[model samples]
Target: MDNIAGSKSSLTWAVHISVALLVALWLFPTVGLFVSSFRTADQIATSGWWSSLSEQESQNPFIRVSGDQVQEGDLYVIEGQLFPETDAEVSAWGTSSREPEAYEPGAVVDLGDGQSLMVNEAGAFRMTSETDMEGTRLPRVFTTATTPPEFTLENYEQVLGGGNGTDSMAQAFISTLTVTIPATVIPIVVAAFAAYALAWMDFPGRALLVAFVVGLLVVPLQLALIPLLKLHLGIGIGKGYLGVWLAHTGFGLPLAIYLLRNYMVGLPRDIIENARVDGATEFQIFTKIILPLSFPALASFAIFQFLWTWNDLLVAKVFLIDATGQTTVMTAKIIELLGTRGGNWEILATAAFVSIIVPLIVFFAMQKYLVRGLLAGSVK
Candidate 1:
């Protein structure tokens, strides 16, 4: 008994540790992206996102002092904050390029010609010289400072149509919504009818039709793109929202039908038959009974189709986006940003996060239905 109890305890601990590891592995990158989106480009370039939440030591190069000098009796003085409008403490300061941290904060250093500079811990600096500070070029001060964690909404604002008008994902966001809603709704509407027919109605070749749809699930979607595009062009639908909607509906139908049919089939058959025996017409029974009971299945398929349609770039490129470039979607826009603003990680992270937010919202909103469908299917 003792041995068995010890083994069980060990196994439970191992399982807990494994789960924790898996969760961390999946969560780290998502958290990193979320953090990176709020950081400036320079901060992101200099430090990892994991360090963004903590104060960090940084070396600043050639921060220029204001050229405006005030006279104090016999000496000319320049007084200013090293980092304006920031919460930072300078640990060390220097006046030359080679030795950036040569002087400790509050220590006065003298140049050969009676010029002296002092930097305080609060990043305030004072320069006094017998001669007036000359020329348009101001003196540069280099410092090592400790900066508190900083975050901003500027990246998100810029990516979502608030910045310099170009390269914003606002248009793409709208286009994705336009593509996803119709694509998800149309397929669910069509697939629900097909699923009900497959699940409950007695028709010839029923098994064969189910098998055909299952076969379609295995067929690569890439195979249909060319032929479908050609057909769309031939039939005068020709590369637009309508063509993309039709393509998504066709692609999404088989899986939706299969999922809904399986769920509908598992439902108690007595209710359906009793409703039919009560003189309820087939359409009435379907509308009033099956549709209501199959909410979980419908919700599951809607979430699936919405996510797929929203994230798809290849299909949008082939069917929706034309030479005019007006119908671009979020995924396509991210790809464009990669090519054009590849170095701008703040923009990229913000754009990617913006694209991800909708699917996450939909998933969470419909999660109860999704979980119910999955559990119902598994238990039986």
Candidate 2:
């Protein structure tokens, strides 16, 4: 009874657990990136995204007090707030880095030569000196503070450039779309025709051709890159959108044909026979019958091609991107940001989220077709 065919397995719980784990593994970083994109640099550096909603308590770097000294009854007074206008509460304060938390909030420290400094939990500070001290160095304060959660759209402003239109990811985004749309569509179109021919047409060398395409799947693109590039150069299509589009088409075709051919071959033979019996030409049958029915497979290939070309850097570097360095894709722009603004994590996160959002939308929108398409010819 337990081993009966078509009955649910007792270990189905294991499969469910495995899938849940995989989803969590893939989802955590993406959600973190999305959350961090809305966060300020200080907030991101201080706490993880999971804790972003709560108050953050961390030891801040030292801040040097700066303000003009006021003369009051022969004594010099310097008054200021370390975290002016913010809701951060200083828990502990210290005058020296070595003893950063030596003093509790509101404790007063006596400096030599008739000077005294007092810091409260609200981050307000006042320094008093018995003698007039106009030309004195300021004291540095190290503080441990608890700050309220902060979220901002400034990261988006910097990445998208709002409206000023300079040094923004917007241009790179458009360039990426320009490259990816053509790259994805061209291969799908060419492969559709080829796949249908291979699946339905009784042509010579069909099996061998299918074998060749399957073989090409294992041939890494790197092996033929230089030679193919040289061919592009020889044909006077050197280093431009057209060259890159053709290159992506060639590189993406094998898998496209293999996938579409397999799916198309699995379609009911009776349908193709009926269409041909009614005097429907191959093109008519393909456009009307095959294409409409093969939507799942087409969408599956589209998603894969779109993702690959959108995130591609190597091909764009070699085939696109002229010497002026004016035409950069989003991936290349992000690399540039990493090099130039390495410490600005907020900017990187925002730009990364911008790049990822489109792909995520595409994936989720077309995901229904994905499994159906990939598994089309596997069972029957």
- Off-target runs (Cα >4 Å) in candidate 1 are 1-3, 110-115, 371-380
Can you tell me which runs of candidate 2 are displaced by over 4 Å? Answer: 1-26, 68-71, 130-136, 162-167, 339-343, 376-380
Which pairs clash in the backbone of model 1? Answer: none
In TM-score terms, candidate 2 sits at 0.84
CA lDDT, every model vs. true structure: 0.88, 0.88
Angstrom error at residue 75, model 2: 3.5
Worst 10 residues of 1 by lDDT: 371-380
RMSD of each: 2.8, 3.9
- lDDT score of residue 11 within candidate 2: 64
| lDDT of each residue in 1-380, candidate 2, tens digit only | 55777655756767789999999999898899889999988889988989999999999999988888999997899999999867899999898999999898887899788998998999999999998777778778999999998899999998898465444899999999999999999999999999999999997999999989888877888777799789988989988889889989999999899889988998999999999999999899999999999888998888888889999998998888878676789999899889987877898899989998898898788887766655752423
lDDT tens digits by residue: candidate 1, 147-253: 88889998988888656755788988999999999999999999999999999999899999998988787688899889999999999999999999999999998
TM-score of 1: 0.90
